[model samples]
Target: MIKFLIKGILRDKSRSLLPVIVVATGVFLTVFMSGFLKGIFNDIAELNAKFNTGHVKIMTRAYAENKDQVPNDLALMDVKKLLSQLKIDYPDMEWVKRIHTGGLIDVPDSFGETRGQGQTIVTAIDMLSPGTHEVERMNIKKSIAKGSLPVKQGEALISDEFAERFGVSLGDKVTLFGSTMNGSMMFNIFVVSGTLRFGNTILDRGAIFMDIRDAQLALDMDDAASEILGYFKVGVYDDIKAQQLQASFNTKYSLKDDEFSPQMFRLVEQEGLGDYLKLANSAGTIMVFIFVIAMSIVLWNTGLLGGLRRYSEFGVRLALGEEKKHIYKTTIYEAMLIGIIGSVIGTGMGLGAAYYMQTYGLDVSSITSNIGMMLPSVYRAEVTPSLFYLGFFPGVIATVLGSALAGFAIYKRKTSQLFHELEV
Candidate 1:
């Protein structure tokens, strides 16, 4: 019976072609949109983890509240001891200390007079430690436009754009003028070992990277760090796991009453990101739901129209002693076959397009240039397991449902009406 139906559908394009096209179009949109949205959300989470927050971040309660100020005054103290304890307590994670501050970069001329000055945001991390992963984690080596990674004390990397604006080059001396953690005047000279282009407009505008030890000395923040970042050994952000870890650490070490006490926060808990993640998820769900409903209505109408055109044929079948239930079931089976074929074609096309996007990505640098948030300029689609089967829901179920609704009219025809129709 199924083979006969398949042959019939193959022979008669009118009965199958239009419905298949509709299902294919719907499935394509469903699959592509699912992959695209998933990619965007994942990128947001990963970028945040790499640049700002880690899987989890620890800071003083005061610093967590006023983090926007880069409050080194409220930074964590005795970080070495804290780091040792963290490594012992959480063997499954990697902990690193980081310092963030803002200061002026003053370039000096041949006679020692200031040549040019600009403000910059400075980030210091463990670049010189043995077996350190900061350089790889931030893709610093790959992003270098000129010169090389800092290999010694008092060496640093400046943004390529900043270097150009100031006419600075590798091995040139630049003085960092900033206040210490105690709010006193401080200045230190560093050799520009490399120039980098991070591809982020905001960061490229004015940024500097230096060794943690150098920053500690320049900022007078010895034995202190602005934040302690923790990453899972697996290198993926798991919100549930992060939340559990945060709760455990805070319960054990954090003091609610002491503003200076250390506090732990998951990535989702910081930078108003929890709300953004919720909104992204809700948007994807609503989008898929809308696609399913809209496609169902369209395919439903197509089935209804096809059924109207087949009234004469159905009447003949009924007149030949065929049961209405059997005819209706056959129509449903035909719809199912059409749905499967269309879905396969559509899924293949969608995955192909998504793979291209995932590889090349769509550049949106112009659109995001002014945005202060840490968003990548190129947006890529992500193909996940869910995307493999997401299109089938709208493709198969909607097609079958539409056919069932349209085929119900078969039972409504009376025997006398059939005979009258046959006479006509």
Candidate 2:
């Protein structure tokens, strides 16, 4: 019976052809679309990590609120101390780094090469414990195109784009000047140590790196850091986890009874970086809708034909004393086969597409002018296992299997009515 069913399906090549093609196309689209979304999210994650935030950052109360607290005051230095003590207690949160940020500065033609103020950006950083901010520092360092990192207070690292923006080369003497946190005048001479390119437009265009000491002194904060940056292997992007880890530093400093605002949690999601998160979510939802609508049409049409054509065969099976359930199961098996085949093909195609896109980011600059973004426009698909599960596999299986079962519903009738279907 099974062999005969196979032969019957194979004999009607034209009827079966579209179904297979539909399955394959649907599967392929699911995988391809999912991988694309995953890629975009990953790129955004990387961008955020390199330029703005890590998995999470702990900022001072006023800083997150933008209420204008002292620019360089460490509102939570006690919290950092508590972190050290908490590590002794919990041991799980041994990794944490303090990060301080300050105003942008420009190197003048007075010191050396003539990159005007508009062309250069200098940012001050402080090294906490010579330990923290090291890994990120290295990552930030490698992105540099030329010149070495500035280890001492006087030295500085300039991004490659800044180098090109001002047409300055390595070893160029640049004068760095910026307002202190106290609004006092500040100036320092820095040798261009390295050129940097971070794949982030803002960072690439106008960002400079200096030792934390340089940042603190340049900003005239004097041992006052903006926030304590920390590192941990897990529990990133969770405010509750941060609150729990705050216990690890218990002995180092006292934790106030005060509650931290949701804004205090500096996860990428909470920071509200806009489309960095929104576009990803939107794409995922959009893909699902498209897949459903697309698959529905494909399945409904295939099911109708597959059902009507097989009606006579089903009637004959019933006449031969095959149970209705048995017929349904057989049809389901056929649907499963088509689904499996389509899913395999789709996954393979989707992976290939994703890999290609990852290597060459989609250039949307041609349309950016039309869309009008203040930032440079680039889009890359983000791929993840979740995306795969959501987009490709489920859609194919549900559509194919459901379609096969739906096809069998057309076979429903009394044994006396079997001849009627056969006659048609």
Candidate 3:
């Protein structure tokens, strides 16, 4: 029976071509859109983790509340001891110290006079520590648009754009004027070892990077850090595991009554990211739902039109003693076969496109430059294991559903009335 249906569909292009084309196009879009949306949301999460938040972050309760203000005065104290204990307690995670401070960078001329100055946000990390992966994690080496990574103490990297704007160059001395952790005025000079462009507009605007040790000296934060970031050794954020870790660590170390006590926060819990993630997920789901419904309606119309066109044919089959149920069932089987074939072809094409996109992303720097967010310049598609079957939901089930609805008319035509219709 299946062979006969296949041969019939092959012989008659009108019976199979248009519906197959519609199903294939819908499936292709479904797969591609799913991959694209997944890529965008995943990039946002990963970028935040690598640059700002870790999979988990540890900070003083006071600092956590005012983290947006970059309040270094409320930073974690005795960080060295806490870091050592965290490494011992959570061997599966990598721990690092980070300091977030904002101040002015003063560029000096040959006469030791200030040539230029710019307000800057500084991020200090464990760049000089042996066996540390912060450099690779942040893509600092690749992002260097000029010079090289800092090799010695008191050297830092500034944004290439900031350097250009201030007429600064490599080997220039820049004075950092900022307040210490104790809220005291402080000034320190640093050599410009390199310039970088992180491809994020917000970070590349007026940002500076320095070693955590240098920041400690400059900010009077010895054995202290604004925040201690913890990342899974696997370099991926696992929300459930992170939540479990946060709960356990808070229970053991954090004191709700003590503002100075250390507290742990999962990635989603910080920076209003939990809401952002929820919004992204909701948007993706709504987009997919809209596409499916749109495609289903179009396919349903196609099935209805095809069934109407075959009315005379169905009437002749009934006159030849064929049961209405058999004819209806055959139409459904044919639609299923068309759905399967279209889904396979469309999934292959969509995956190929997605793979290419993932390899070489689409650049949207011009569009995102003015936007004050941490989004990357390039957009890529993320083809997951689910994408292999994601298309079948719309391709197979929707097509079959449309055909089932259209086939109901098969049982409505009476054999006695078919003779009168056939004559007309």
Task: List all candidate RMSDs to the true structure.
Answer: 2.1, 5.2, 1.7
Error of 3 at 337 (Å): 1.6
Task: Say which prediction, candidate 2 or candidate 3, comes out ahead on TM-score.
Answer: 3
How do the residues 94-193 of candidate 2 rate in per-residue lDDT, one tens digit apiece? 3343334434445556544445665444444443346555536446655657766665556777777667877777777776665665677767666776
Clashing pairs in 3: none
Candidate 3: 10-residue stretch with minimal lDDT? 287-296
Those runs of model 3 whose alpha carbons end farther than 4 Å from true positions after fitting are none
Tell me model 2's lDDT, rounded to 2 decimals: 0.59
Task: Give me candidate 1's TM-score against the actual structure.
Answer: 0.93
Candidates, ranked, TM-score: 3, 1, 2
The lDDT for every candidate, in the order shown, is 0.89, 0.59, 0.88
Which candidate tops TM-score? 3
In the range 1-424, model 1's lDDT, one tens digit per residue, is 7888999899889899998888888888888887888788878877888888998999999999999999999999999999999999999999999999999999998899999999999999999999999989987998799999999999999999999998998899999999999999989899999998877776888899999999999888999999999999998888998888998899998997999999999988887778888887787788778877787788788888988888888899998988999999999999899999988888887887888889998888788866777787788999877777888767888889889888898899787798788777
Reference-based lDDT, residue 109, model 3: 86
